[model samples]
Target: MIALNSIVSTFNPDDQQKFITYLQSKNKRRDTKNIQLFKFLIKEELSSKDICKQLYNVVQCNAYHALRKRLFQSIIDFIANNNLEDENSIDMQIIKYILASRTFLLQKNYDVAYKILDKAEKLADENSLFPILNEIYHTKIQYAPYYPKIELKDLINKQQENQKKHQLEDQLNIVYAKLTSLLNAISYKGEIIDFESELQIILNAHNIELQDSLSFKSLYQILAIANISALITTKYYQIENFVLKSYSILKQKKETEKQLFYQIQIVYLIANTLFRNKRFEKSLNYIQEMQELMLLKKGIYLKDFILKKTLLEALNLNYNNQQQKAIDLIEIAISNKHRDIEALLDLHLSLLMFYFQKEDFTVAKSVLSKFYHTDQWYIEKAGIDWVIKKNVAEILLYIEIREEDLLYSRLKSFRRRYKKYLTEIKQTRIFTFLNFAEQYYKNPEGFSTDITRNKIENAFTWTTVHKEDIFVMSSYAWLKSKIDKSKLYSTTLELIKKA
Candidate 1:
């Protein structure tokens, strides 16, 4: 029992051989108990080769059935000792050891089996053992003769390495596919699935050593892309630093295509961040840089498609600042046939604003009428489109003869019926409407007191409650002053002073 414990603890090949020799010298005919003990020792410690040799000798001496029965009992004893009845609970390392033993049991060479099992054990230790074990069990049942020991070992190692490389590549590909799907989903009113956990799983799989290889450089590029998307989705403001680090790594390897892709994404993200922060000119400059890169690439790349949309956004931002360059860019985009319905809609909205600024109500009304009649008008309101649709509502109110009462009632009804939707309305558009309503009431013509009061009050209640919204803060404060001149005036004055 002490010897058996040593064998189990050490698991050394030399210890196994000593047990095999001891078993062979024991009595085979005189004492059945001794013979059984010998067989048990053989099963417990020796390689399958030594066990099989003893079985053959017993059969030659006319004790074949007894030896076979003893061999079966030994197998049962080994399993019992190891407590391995439920193979599912066995650690991958132990399972690989068992597989190695079985390979020798089947009269195959030991070296090939040991190498394969070693690799499997390593993978199992990394908590990535499931796939490898599944493959082994699947192939073990269809056991064939082992003839290619050295070659098979080399091939298995190569394949395992290749599979690891492919997994990283596949993750990068998935990130791009998911980002494109998300953007397109927003365009088409489709739902986006939560991809954060899955992305983290992939990132965790990446090994720094693997990234140093030429074969994995392409995959590293993919990793960079995935990281960018994760940053964008999670609003990780430190994305520029993360991207710059990844870019530096890629640049060190001179991976130009990947570098270009990462650069485009970085530029896009920076432009988007600037736009959100209301840095219109900086956003336009970033978009122009993206456009220049796309032109340099002859418009054949994925970045080109992305830059086209961003260019429209930049133009819209410029138009918001009442710049003529915005109109020039829109005309160029429309004439070049690069403008989709989104860009055209943006252009129409810009033109309406431009006309409004110039007090050309006739052209503004005409342009807005055409915009309201377009297919995009309905498509933009499908609740999935990311662009604000309230702008259309705002324009429609401008041209309609009975707009004041009807528009106010419709907006109020929408707020009450779709309280959740109210949260989704763009803050910029909400503030625009609020400011417009307030200005209309303050007109020298003397607006209706009760109607204007209710409109201002409703806007105030909604906007002030969401006071973190920068666009609506001023309008909210102004409405408060109108509603309660004394208390609100002092509070609003303090708030504005702080701003």
Candidate 2:
């Protein structure tokens, strides 16, 4: 798994440039070595010796180590000063003051220490930084003997209050983490067997009452658990209630930058759930809301939100029987620079689906070509388990474009690669569909029958049973469209309507 902190850093070029600029501004001599070294470290894996030889032209190990330390320190300094205007900076500054106070206390400067603690306490209280306020209270109690002017009763009361807030935050955070872990576990599986009992256990254990969610963080965490549970259990309508609750709570307050990001996530979760439920118009409305928020905030995670919004819009259009419009939107999405390689791969796949559904075999083939070329890199970049889905799409593409030889080879390859796992996951329809598709490819004229076509349509329907979560299986409709001699999109829409 990718380290959590490094995940966002993977595609952040703007932050790197800002760090370089910050370093330049900080240095009196404008030394370029540190900036160059930082850039090299980010882009490549190199030893200290390699870095020393390349940048400093020295063989001394100690000298290289010393320079490495300085370079590391410079990066830290750059990050510290980069966004002091951000709201979280209040917490950061409070911590800094607390540390300063500690240093003063150690040096026997009681006056300076108490003054620093007072400043930190005021900032913590003003910002509702209860966690930091707890720290402030502890520090004040530690120095109480040195300063008898401190009111012990008042300090004790505030400390108790901060402690309660900290406990609440901690409980919410732990519950959120557990829910997030469960969500990740079920995401790829795309099915639920008996998660309701587990979810109830979590709620009971965590004492997670939505009514008790008094803070933004607590409310967001509560909604997140509900949203993820709804997803896992396929209870999509449940997501709407949580979404509304989150929106109502968030709108009533002044959101910090962090809260806004969480709000955006709530919007995404609801829109996605609506889309899954085939509420296309409502989904599009949420998508618009998300887009407006993106335009208003332009958060650092802009690329991800844009990718999601664009994909949701495309899916809404495609499922609503607007293949060409969906294709157009996907084209625009793929043309843009994307920080998320996984989303990019997904967009390419969606584009291929649109083209294939439209029976534009030539364009579909081209999209598949692009998909194949970039696929390996995307797998490496995103660490996604795409082997089954990727191979399945390729096989379907081959079938659509009438590449009989390629279709035969791809069918064999896909079965070999995913047969065991597909069976394990009870996704036998995928294997069945591939078998039917292979038969259809070799004998298109003889492939049609009420029995056989229904079976094939059932396979397609099974593939799309979790359409909101898993990749779409367009083979059934594609085959049905071919057998029925109808438009693929219209037939797929009918199948969806029936489903």
Clashes of each: 0, 0
lDDT of 1 at 166: 53
Candidate 2 ranges beyond 4 A from true positions: 1-21, 30-72, 89-129, 132-165, 182-204, 209-214, 230-235, 295-298, 320-325, 332-339, 370-385, 446-476, 494-499
244-270 in candidate 1: lDDT tens per residue?
A: 444455345432332444456555655
Q: Which candidate's lDDT is highest?
A: 2
Q: Model 2, residue 121: displacement in angstroms?
A: 10
- Candidate with the greatest TM-score versus the true structure: 2
Q: Which stretches of candidate 1 lie over 4 Å from their true place?
A: 1-165, 175-187, 190-266, 279-285, 297-313, 316-322, 350-362, 373-387, 390-418, 423-499
lDDT of each: 0.47, 0.70
Report the lDDT of model 1 for residue 96: 58
The digit string of per-residue lDDT tens for model 2 on 283-334 reads 8998988887775533565655888788889999898878788888989878
| Clashing residue pairs found in predicted model 1 | none
Q: Please give each candidate's TM-score.
A: 0.44, 0.70
